[model samples]
Target: MTLLSVDNLSKSFGGLMAVNDVTFEVESGSIVGLIGPNGAGKTTVFNLITGNYQPNTGTVLFDGQNLVGLPTHTIVEKGIARTFQTIRLFQNMTVLENVLAGAHCRMRAGCIAAMLRTPAQRREEEEAMRQAMGELEFVGLGKEWQNKAKNLSYGNQRLLEIARALATKPKLIVLDEPAGGMNDQETQELITLIRAIQDRGITVLLIEHDMGLVMRVCSSLVVLEHGAKIASGTPAEIQSNPRVIEAYLGADSE
Candidate 1:
């Protein structure tokens, strides 16, 4: 099933057309990669889908609902969540607290209940902590639950970001440059984690520059150049695509 669709999406900043007539759909339980050279409008498309920016033109449908005018938190509550190209975590908070914050949408304890510390509210808070810990385990960070998010190694911090996003209970997850700055071994671990995520029935929309990671993890890919789609296909097809080669790989011999 197509869980999300973008038709003829366009965005501009002043005179620069950042994303022009770009379109794609993400099927339920599938991984779709969006790739491009620098300034190819990949992240811009992500922002549009997540309601960070209003599209200049076109439609964005998430779970058959138009996402154009919805606020960011509303979009998240609708079962979409995303991580940034740069890791955004609460540096001062414990790893578990960050994940608990992601679970805010599902929390049932209101202000009065929380302030009163009623039995029901206490149970709700305990359940939220349990759920957050489960998410931490899912991302292989359960042991770091008490540590400050900023104190972890860079790789662990990235994984923590994914864990926190997962805590939001999204049906679809968008990852931006997930493997960026990782060494070969770390990338291998990332490949495994990404597959595990997809296996859990959450559709993944990936924006990545590491061709290696993209080829290994993505079942399908959309290549963009100057805000327009230039090519899209399986990894094998993308490898042979002349337009992708010219736009992303240039004249350098393969």
Candidate 2:
């Protein structure tokens, strides 16, 4: 099934057309890669899908609901969550607190219910915390729940962001440059973690520059250049495609 579909999506900022009439579908339970050069507008697509920008044209359908014009929080409520290219953790907050913050989207208790601490509200809050802890553990950070977000190693900090996104209980999680800075071991761990995320049946849309990791993690690839899609196929097909080679990898690269 196509869990998320972007049809004829386009976004413009003044004179810059960041993403132009790009369309793609991410099937449920697959790791789909969105790849291109530095200025290819990959992140712009992410912004558009997540409601950070209003598209000039086209539609974004998540589980069949139109996402354009929705607020970011409303988009999150619609079961689409994403992590930014840079780590966006609550630096001063505890590792667990950051995850709980993401869970706020799932909380039913309003300001009054929260202040009065109604029995039902307390139950809901407890469930949210429990889910947060589970998310931390799922990302191998269970033992550091009490630590501050800034205190974690760089790689763990990235994992914390993922854990926070998971706390929202999203059906589709979009990760932007997840392996941006990492050692070999850290990258390998990320590969495993991404596969594990897929195993949990959550659809993943990945924006990455690391072709090695993309090839290993993604079942399919979508190539974008100058805000338009050029080619899309399985990993092997993407690697050998002449246009992808000349446009992205450069003619001299393997």
Per-prediction TM-score to the true structure, in the order listed: 0.96, 0.97
Query: Per-residue alpha-carbon lDDT of model 1 for 32-135, expressed as tens digits?
Result: 99999999999999999999999999999988999999999999999998988989999999999999989877777799998999999989889889999999
> Between which residue pairs do clashes occur in model 2?
none
Can you write out model 2's per-residue Cα lDDT over 1-254, one digit (the tens) per residue?
A: 99999999988889998998999999999999999999899999999999988899999998888988999999999898898898998899999999999998999889999999999899999999999999999999999999999999988998999999999999999999989887789989999999999999999999999888998899999999999999999998998999999889766555
Q: After superposition, how far is residue 66 of candidate 1 from its true place, in Å?
A: 0.5
Q: Name the runs in model 1 displaced over 4 angstroms.
A: 250-254
Candidate 2's error at 55, in angstroms?
A: 0.5
Q: RMSD to native for every prediction?
A: 1.3, 1.1
Question: How big is the positional error of residue 1 in model 2, measured in Å on the Cα after superposition?
Answer: 1.0
